[model samples]
Target chain A: MPQRIGQYTVATPSRPALLSYAAAVGNKEGDGPLGSCFDYIAEDTTMGRGSWEQAESMLQKTAVQIALKKIDLAARQIDLIFAGDLLNQCIGSTFGLRDFGIPLIGLFGACSTMALSLLNAALAVDAGAARYAVAVTSSHFCSAERQFRQPLDYGGQRPPTAQWTVTGAGACVVGHGEGIAVEALTPGRVVDLGIKDANNMGAAMAPAAADTILRFLKDTGTEPGDYDRIFTGDLGVIGSRLLCELLDKEGIDLRAVHRDCGVMIFDRERQDVHAGGSGCGCSASVLCAHILPEMAAGRLKNVLFCATGALMSPTSSQQGESIPGIAHLVHLRA
Target chain B: MKPTKKEYDAMTNKASPPSPKGKNSVFAFLIGGAVCALGQALLEGYRAWGADLETAKTLVSVTFIGLTVLLTALHLYDKYAKIAGAGSLVPITGFANAMASPAIEFKTEGPVTGVGVKMFTVAGPVLVFGISASMVYGLILWVIGLFD
Candidate 1:
C-alpha cells in the first residue's frame, strides 16, 4: 500500500520507474518553443479524422502507441491505463484507447489531469497492483473551443487573459523498476478564491496551485530550495506571477526555482497565445517530451511538478457558479 | 501570513500582460461600415448585370453569407471580427458566421451527429422564431383583408 504522509500527501514506498513516454502535438503547438521535443508533430490537426473530437481521440491513440513502442512493451503487457481529456464524458480517452484492451480508469481533473493521472499510476505501481501501467491525457484546441467556449467560426474575440488550449496528447509508461521515481504525491482541495471569470484561468487556478504547494511542503517537511524546480500546470504568465506572490506572502520564496509549464511551452512575445498555452495537453506534453528527457539526462534531480485545474462546466458557468480549482502535486526524483 | 499594506502592494505589483479592454466601438464602427460597403458593392454589381431589383437584393445577401463562410474557413474572419468587435455582427455575415462556425468546429464529431446536429444549434432557434413570427403576422394581415 502507498504510505500516507499527512493530509493528502502519499509516499509511494515502492518507487516506480517511468519506463518511457511519448507526445504528439498539432501544427500550432508544434511551432512552440518546446516543439522539437515532441515525438510527433502532426501535419494535419484532424489526423485524417472527420471531426475535431475524433482527431483528439486519434491523438491519444497515437501517443500511447508511441509510448508503448518506446519501451518495446506490447499493449497486452500493460496491466492498466489511466486516461482522460477535456471532452464531455472523456470520449477522447474512451474512444481513443479502446483498442488497447487494457482496463481503464477514466479521470477528470480538468486541466490538472496530467499530474492526477501520473500520481494515480505511480500509486498503482507502488502498491504492486500492476506490473506495468500507462497514464495518458490529451486536449485539442478546436475540440476544447467547441465544448467550453464559442465555436471557432463564431468569430468571437478572445480576451488577452484567455489561454490557447494546446492541441496535443501525451502518454507515459510506469513500472516498479529503475527510472525517475515518484517521491511523494499531494492531492489538492477544491480551492475557490471567489474567481468567476472563466477566461482568466491563470488567476482562477493560482490559488489552488499555491494551496497544494504549501500543503506538500509542510507535509514533506521540505523547503522551496529542496527541489531543483517547482513546475506548475498551465497557470500562464498571470497565474505564475500570482503564485509567486502567494508564496512570498507565506515567507516561502520561489524566486529562483519557480517555473510554469505554461510559460515554458510557448514564446509568449512572438506567439499570439495570449496568456500562454493551457489545457491537459499543455503540461502533459511538456513534462513527457521536455522535462522527462532532462531528468533522464541527469540535469534535473529532484523536482516538484504541480498541475492545477479549473473544474467548471458550461452549465455551471451559466448558473453563475465560481470556478473551483484543484492542483495535484507529484514529486519526481532522478 | 497577514501582510501589511506595504508588503501587499509590493507583492501584487509585478508587471504582467495588459488586461482586456472594455472600449473599441470606434473600430467596430469603421470595420462594420467596410463590411457593409462590400455588401453594397455586390448589390450594385448584380444590378449592373441586368438582374431585377428583388433578385439583386437576394443575390447580395447570399453573396455576403457565402463570402463570410469562405473567409471563416480560410481562418481570416475571426481576426477581422476581433478588430471589428460587434461591427462584424452586421446581420447577414454575422448570421452566416454563427451557423458556419459551429458546423466547422463540430465537423469532427462525424457528419450525422457532429455537423448535422450542431449546425442547427445556433441557426435553429433563429429559423424557428423567424418563420413562426412571419406566419403569425401574415395570418393577421389576411384576417384584416377578409373584412375588406
Candidate 2:
C-alpha cells in the first residue's frame, strides 16, 4: 500500500490572526507546548453562517477542494474518500461531499479526526481497498459553538481552557505507488481513562493516547526514541504534562521528541492558547502542512502521530458521570 | 457528615439509590412518569415544528436551555432530574438542565471553576461520545481494512 502524501490543506472559520490572538490569550495562564501547530497550505475565507451542519459542509468542501487541486484528480478517478470534522452529523464532511460522486465515509474522532481519517486512507491503500483516497476534516469555532455551546454571534469572552477553533481545514490524499508515502504504521489501540468531563478533553484523551502509543511501540518492537517525533492530536499543556507523567509511570521515558498539535498552534501568552488543545484541525494542519512539507524537504524522517479523543455522553453526564476517552496512532515514514 | 457545596455538586450526579418509604413509591412513580410524559410531548412537538434539522436542534437546545434555566431558577431542575431520571435525559434540554442544576447547587465553588465547568458538564458527554465513538469507528475501519 503506497500511502502517497500527495496533497494537504487546512480550512478554518477564524482568520489566522484571530486564531493567533485567541491562542495567545488562552496561553497566558500557562507555558505552551508543541510546534508550528496550525500552519497549512491553503485557507478558505468564504464561510457560511448557519447551524454547525451548514458550516461544517462548507469547511469540509474547502479542505477537500484544496487537496484535490494539488493532486488534480477528478472525483471519479479517486478510489474513495475518508473524512471527519467536528460536527454532529459529520456535517462538514458528508454534505460537502454530497455531490463529489465518490464513495464517502464520515468519521468523528473530534480533534483527532484528521489522523483517524488519514489512518483509514492509509489502510485503504495498503489493504488494497482503493488506489487513491481523499482524507480531510474541518473545525469551525462558530459552527462548533453554535452546535455545542452558545451561538456564533453570542458575545462572550472565552476562558483560558477554551481553545480557538482553527478557522482552517486540512486534508491530504494517499495514492498507491509513489511520492512521499506512509510506508510503515503501528495502528493505535483505543484506551479509555474514564475521565468524562468534556471541558478537559486534554485530560480525558491523554491517558488513552499514552496507553496506545505505549502499546504500539511495544508491539511493533519499536522504541519511542525510534521516531524523530512522537506527537498526539490535542493534548494541550496540562494534558501534555500528564501524558509525560503517565508515560514515566509505565517506565517509558520519552526524552527524545514528543509534541502536541494543540500546544503548537500558537505562541503562549501572545496567543491566549491556554493549555493548548483545539478541534481536529489542530493536528490536521500541523501534519498536513508543516510536518509533511518538512518531510518532503528531507528535514524530517520517520514520525508518529497519535490522535486522541474523549468519549462522553449526555446520558452518562446527566446520570452524573465522567466521559470515556480514546486514542489512535499512524506512524509515517519517509 | 453532609457534603459541602462543592462535594454536593460533584456527588449530585452520583446520587445514591433511593431508600423507599413503606407504600407511596408507586404513587410517586406514577406522578413522576406523568410529568415526564408532558415534557416529552412538548419536546416532540418542538421537534416536529417546521424548521431545518439544524434549526430544530438549536431550537430544542435553546428551548431546553430556557426551560431548564427557568426550572433552575424555580428550583425544579434537580427535583425533576431525580424524579424523571432518563426522562430528564434523552433530550438535549437535559444538557441545559445539567449545567444550570449544578450552578444552583455549587454556586459556592466560586464563579469560574464551579459555575463555568458545571456549564459544560451537560454538554461534556456529547464531546466524549462523539470523540470515543469516532475513534472506535476509525479503529474498526483500520482493522477491517487489514482483512480486506
Candidate 3:
C-alpha cells in the first residue's frame, strides 16, 4: 500500500498564486460579468477544425504568463509542462506556449483539466521526472456551448439543469517542494452512466461523480469524514442534489461543506443561472482563484477536488444523442 | 326531531362560502388558446379529406395525440420545448411530450430498472390526479341523478 502521508506532513511549498496574463478574446464586458467570458472559444462555423488549435494556444500563453508572474521565474527556467483544456490537440494553451519553448505535454479531461494537469505535474515531481513542472488548463465558454448544442444567437433558452460555461484560463506550478507537497493521487476512473439524453446532463453526471468519489475513498482508505471539504467541478444544482442523493444511498455521506463551482459562480436570482455553470474553465478558474488562496491561507487542509465532465461528441449527440459523463479526482493535501 | 333549530342553524353558519375570484387568468387564456387552435387545425386539415365536423374533431385530437406520443418516445418534443419555451407548455403536446423525459433520465442504470418501470414516470402522477378529479365529478353527477 502506498504510504498515505500521515497527519501534519504538508507545509505547502507553493504560494497561493495568480499570474498576470489574461486576455478576454471573446465579446463581453471586461468587468466582473455575471456569466462566462468567452462568447466563442473558436468560431468552428467559420474556422474549420483547425480553429480549435488556435484557441487552445491562446489559453496556454495566458496560463504561462500568469504562472511566471507568481514565481518571478522566466519561461527559460521552467523545464516541463503539463497543459490541458476541453479542446483537442491542447490547442488553446499549447499553441500559445509554443513560442515560450517549454517542453509541453498536452492533456485533456474536460472541466477536470486542472486536476488532470495537477496529477501529472505532481507525478513529475514525485517521480523526479523534472525539477520544475507547470500544470495548465483553459476553457472558452462560447466555443463549448456552440459546439455542444446550438448558437447563442439562435435564442436557445437553456433548461434549469443546463449550465453556463466560464471563459477563463488558470495554471499552477508543481515543482520540487519542501513546503506543501502533493499528498495523494486518487486516480479517477470512467463510470459510464449510459444516459443518452443530452438535454439532461445532471442525470448523466451525478452517478459518475458518486462512482469516482466512492472509488477514491475505497482505494485511499480515507473515511468520508476524513476531509473537511469535498468539491466537484461543475455538477451545478441538479447534479449536486443527485450526487448527494446517490452517495447517501451508498451510505457514503460527504462533507456538510461539499460544494460545486458551477453553483457558486453566479447569483442565481440576479443572473438567472438556471442549473449552474459547467465547463473546464469553471473548475480551473475557481480552483486557482478561490480554493488555492484558502489552501495557502491554511484555511483548508485536505481537499478532494473531483472535476466532472461530459465526454460525448457533437456527432454522437446528433445521432440518437447520448451524453456519457466522466469525473476525475485530485487529492491536494495542504 | 332530527335536530334542534339552534343546532341546525349553528352547523349551517359554520360552512364558509367559496371565494368567487376567477381562476388563473394567464393559465386560462393560454389553455383556451391551445385547445381552440388544436381543435380548429384538426377540423380544417381533415375537412380537406371530406370528413364530417364531429369526425374531423375526433381525427384531429387523435392525430395530435399520436404526434405527441412519437415525439414523447424519441424525445424530440423536449428539444422543441427548449425553443418554444412557454408556448410549448400551452398545448396538449406539452403534457405528452414531458412523458418520456423523466423515464429517459432514469433509464441509464438498466432497461428493466430504467425503461420498463420508468415509462410511467410522469404519466403515473398525471393520470392519478386526472382520474381522481374525474371520479369526484362523476360522483357528483350520479348523486344529482337521484334527485332528478
* Candidate scoring better on TM-score of 1 and 3: 1
Error of 2 at A234 (Å): 0.4
Candidate 2 runs further than 4 Å off: A1-52, A152-159, A186-190, B1-148
How do the candidates rank by TM-score, highest first? Answer: 1, 3, 2
Off by over 4 Å in 3: A1-57, B1-148
User: Which digits, one per residue and each the tens of the lDDT, describe model 1 over residues A172-287?
Assistant: 99997778988889988998776677888887788889889999999988998998999998999888888888888898998799998888888887988888989999999999
State residue A332's C-alpha deviation in candidate 2, in Å: 0.5
- Model 1 chain A weakest 10-residue run by lDDT: A152-161
Model 3, range A1-334, lDDT digits (tens) per residue? 1244333111222332222222222222112242343222322321233343455456556556766766687877777888777665556665667798889888877776777777667666666666677777776764565456542322124545556776666677777543345566554555554566565565567767877787777666676688867888888876787777667767777748688877776565556556676677777766766666667679987787878877777778768655666787777766
Q: What are the TM-scores, per candidate, against the unseen true structure?
A: 0.89, 0.60, 0.62
Which prediction has the highest lDDT against the true structure? 1
Full-model lDDT for every candidate = 0.88, 0.61, 0.62
Q: Which is the winner by TM-score between candidate 2 and candidate 3?
A: 3
Q: Model 1, range B30-114, lDDT digits (tens) per residue?
A: 8888878887888889999999999999999988889889998988888888888788886588889888987887776678898
Worst 10 residues of 3 chain A by lDDT: A8-17
Which CAPRI tier for candidate 1?
Answer: acceptable
Model 2: fraction of the reference interface contacts it also forms? 0.00
